[model samples]
Target: MRDPLTVSGPEGPSFWAEHAWLGTHVEPGVVLDTGADGRITAVRTGVAAPPPGAVPLRGLTVPGLANAHSHAFHRALRGTVQTGAGTFWTWREVMYRVAARLTPDTYHALARAAYAEMALAGITAVGEFHYLHHGPDGTPYADPNAMGEALIEAARDAGIRITLLDTVYLHGGLTADGHQPLEGPQIRFGDGSADAWYERWTRLRERADGDRVTVGAAVHSVRAFAERDGYAAFAERTDGVPVHVHLSEQPAENEACLAVHGVTPAALLDRHGFWKPTTTAVHATHLTDDDIRILGASGAGVCMCPTTERDLADGIGPAAALQRAGSPLSLGSDSHAVIDLLEEARAMELDERLRTRTRGHWTAAALLRAASEDGHTALGRPGAGSLEPGAPADFTTVALDTVRTAGPVPGLAAEAVVFAATAADVRDVVVCGRTVVGGGVHRTVPDPAGELARAIAAVTT
Candidate 1:
C-alpha cells in the first residue's frame, strides 16, 4: 500500500462539500483546501458551488471519525461470539483461541480487512490497544515486534491513521489472593516485566513515523501490574506519549482490586501517580464517586465503547458527570460488535438517558465532538477531527438522502447524522488529502466484505 502522505502533488487537493459541519453548526457550500503536507491550509464557507478544480462532495460532510480504542483482532470474533451466553470473562476464552491461531501474516490480513471496514465507517484514525506480542506458546518471533509491525502495516494498507498503543500485560488475571501467573495464550501478551516492555516499546517508538503512525504505550489493566510502585515508574518512562489502560469495566474487577489493594482501581492508580493528562482510561463503567473525582481532577481522558459495553452487559457509565468534572470524553468501537462511530456516539447519550430516565443529556454537536475531536486527541492527534485550517485533511461525507438520514432540517444535519445515520450512510472518506472511500466503496481494498469474511474464517474456523 502506498502512503497517502506521499501521493499528493505539490498543490495538494481541494474539496467542496454541499453541507459541512464546522464543529458548532452546519454550513452550506464549504470549500476546504489542503497543503502538500496533508494538513488543511484554508477553509472557506458561503461558496456557492464547487470550484473548477475542487472535488465535489455531496450530502453532509464532517471531520473524520476516530476509533479511540480498538482490538483489531477482535473483529474476527464478531458474529461467532454472539451466539453463546457469556460474560466478558467467558468471551475471553474464545478470543484467546483465535489469538493462538494468528501469525504475523494472518494477523496482517485480518487487520487490513478490519481497518478497511473502519474506513468504510468513516473512521480515519484508530488507536489499536494491541497486546498480542510474540508468537503463540510464549515464544518470540525472529522479530519480537512482528505482531505490532503487522498491525502498523495493516493500517497503512487500509489507508487509515493508526496509533499503535502497544500494551504491557504482565499477569493473566487478578484475584482476591493476588495476581496470577500468565498461562496458556496469555503468555504471549507478557513481556516479563515493565523494563523489558519499555525496552521493546523504545524500539517500536524509533520506527514510528509520528504523523500517520504514532506509537503509544498501554498498561493492560490494574490487574496486569503486580506492584503499585511499577505504575509510577511506567508512567515516568512513558511520559509525553499517550498511555491508556482498561479501568473497572466489570464490578468483579473492582471487587477484586478492593480486596487485594484495599482501594478501587482508579484510586489505586491515582495513588501511584499513574493518572496524567496524557493518560486515557477505557470503559470506566464501574467507577466510584471518589474514582470519578480522582480521574476528573487528574485531567485524564475517558474513552467509552458503548456497543461493547452493551454487548457485554456492562452498566452505563457516568459520562455526563465525568465531563462536568473536567474529563474529556471519546468514543471507540471496542470488540467491534459494530464499527459505526455514529452509533457509538448516539449510544453513549441514549444509554445515559436510559439510566437516568431523562432526555438530552448531550447535544448532537457534543456527541460528535466525543466521536471526532476528543477521540483524535486521545489517540495523540490533537489537531485532527475538524475541518479547519491547520487540521489534518480528513473528512467523511454521509448521504443525506439515505433512508434513515432523510427528512431532517438543514440546520439539524449534525443531529440527523449522529442520531439517525449508520455506517452505510457514509458515501466518501478522505484521509491525508487522499480519498480512500468514494461513493460508499473502498478504493484500495477492492472488496472489504469478502476480505473480512475470508480473514475471519481463517481464524475462527
Candidate 2:
C-alpha cells in the first residue's frame, strides 16, 4: 500500500533526510514529497531508507534560511571598511561612495553575485532593503523603476525568492532645524516626495511577477522620511503588503525624531498608521519602553541583524523584551557582514547574555523559528519556511559530521546546528524543490567568490 504520508504531485522527486527539523524538533527518517509546482504535497517521518525514487539528504535538514533584511550593494563594503575605526556616520560616507557608483546594470551584477553567495549559505529568500534609485544626479531613469527591476532580476538569476523592498528616501537628514534638502549622494536615493515614491512603487508592483517576487515598501528611516504627508497616504495604499522601516538604529535618529516630531521614531510611525501586522521595524535598537509596547501590541515583527549591529557598533536591541511583549522575532544578515543565519541566531542569545549577564533567555527552537519561519513571514512569504504539506519545498541540510557539529545527540541536533554550525557546514540546499547547492557548492552560479570580486570591482573601480 502507498504510504499514508505520500500524496499526488507533478511527478517531482521526493527528499528523504537522515534528520529534518519539523518546526519544533529534529526528527529522523523524514521524507518530504514535492509536487511539480514546487510545493510540499506530504511529509512523513520514520521511514528507514530513501523511498523508491527519493533523493537522500544526509544531514540535519531545516527550512531554508530567510534573510529578512539586506542591503545588497553593501556586500561590496564587506572587507573594505573593517580596517578603520569609525562610527555608523563615518561608515555611511564610505557606503555612500559605493552607492554613487552603481548603475542599474552594475547593481544587477552586484546583487546577482551577492544573492548567489546567499544561496551558498542556505538562504532561499531575501528581503532586499533597496533604496538607491534614480541617477547620481537625482534624475529618474528612463523606466523610473529600473533599479528595482534589476534587483528582481538578480534574485531570479540566483534561483531564490525575493521581496523587493522599494524604499522611500525623501529628505537628506533631519535635525532640530527641520528636514534638510537632498545633497550629493543622497540625491539619488530620493524620489522627491512620498507621492512620487508611491507612483513609482505602484508601477513596480504592477510589473512584478508574483510567483517568486513580492513588491514591498519601506520608509528609509525617520531621518530620511521627515515629511509625513506622503508616507501617510502611502501607508493606506499598501494594505496586505510587507512594509519595513529603519527605526532607531542609532541614537541620533531618535534624538532627531524627538527634536522635530516630539516623539520616538516608533511613535511617529505609529502616528502615521505605518505600524501594522504586515509591517516590520528593522534595527529597533534604541527603542523606549513605549516603543517596545507599541511594536508588540501592534503585532508587528522585529528583525535583528546581529553581525551588522556589532559591526556598526549599534547597541544590542531589546530582543527578549520585544519577544515577551508579544512581538515575533526574525533574523537578517543586513549588510552581509556574515551570510550565515546560524551565527545570527546564536548571537541573539550571546548578545543578550552580554547585556543582561544572564543565560538561556531563548531556547534553540525559538531561535530556529525566528531564523526560519518568522523571517519568511517578515519578508511577505507567509506559510513558507516549513516542511509541511502546502509549504514551499525550500530547505537546507547541515552535516552532523562537521567538526563543529560532531557531538550533539539526536534530540539536541537543533541546538547544535544553531550554536555550533556555520554556513560552511551547510551540505545541501533545495529551493522550490530545486537543488541549488549540493556538497557545499552552488549548482548554477560557479565561482561565487570570483563573481562577487568582479561585480564589486565593476562598481568600486
RMSD of each: 1.0, 3.9
- List clashing residue pairs in candidate 1: none
What's model 2's overall lDDT?
0.89
Predicted structure with the largest lDDT when compared to the true one: 1
Best of the candidates, TM-score: 1
Name the weakest run of 10 consecutive residues (lDDT summed) in model 2: 1-10
Per-residue lDDT of 265-374 in model 1, one digit per residue for the tens?
Answer: 99999988999879999999999899999999999999999999999898899898999888999999999999999999999999999999999999999999999999
> How does each model score on TM-score?
0.99, 0.97
Give the least accurate 10-residue stretch of model 1, judged by summed lDDT. Answer: 1-10
lDDT of 1 at 443: 89
Q: What lDDT score is found at residue 183 in candidate 2?
A: 96
Model 2 spans > 4 angstroms off: 1-9
> Model 2 shows how many backbone clashes?
1
- Where is model 1 more than 4 Å wrong at Cα? none
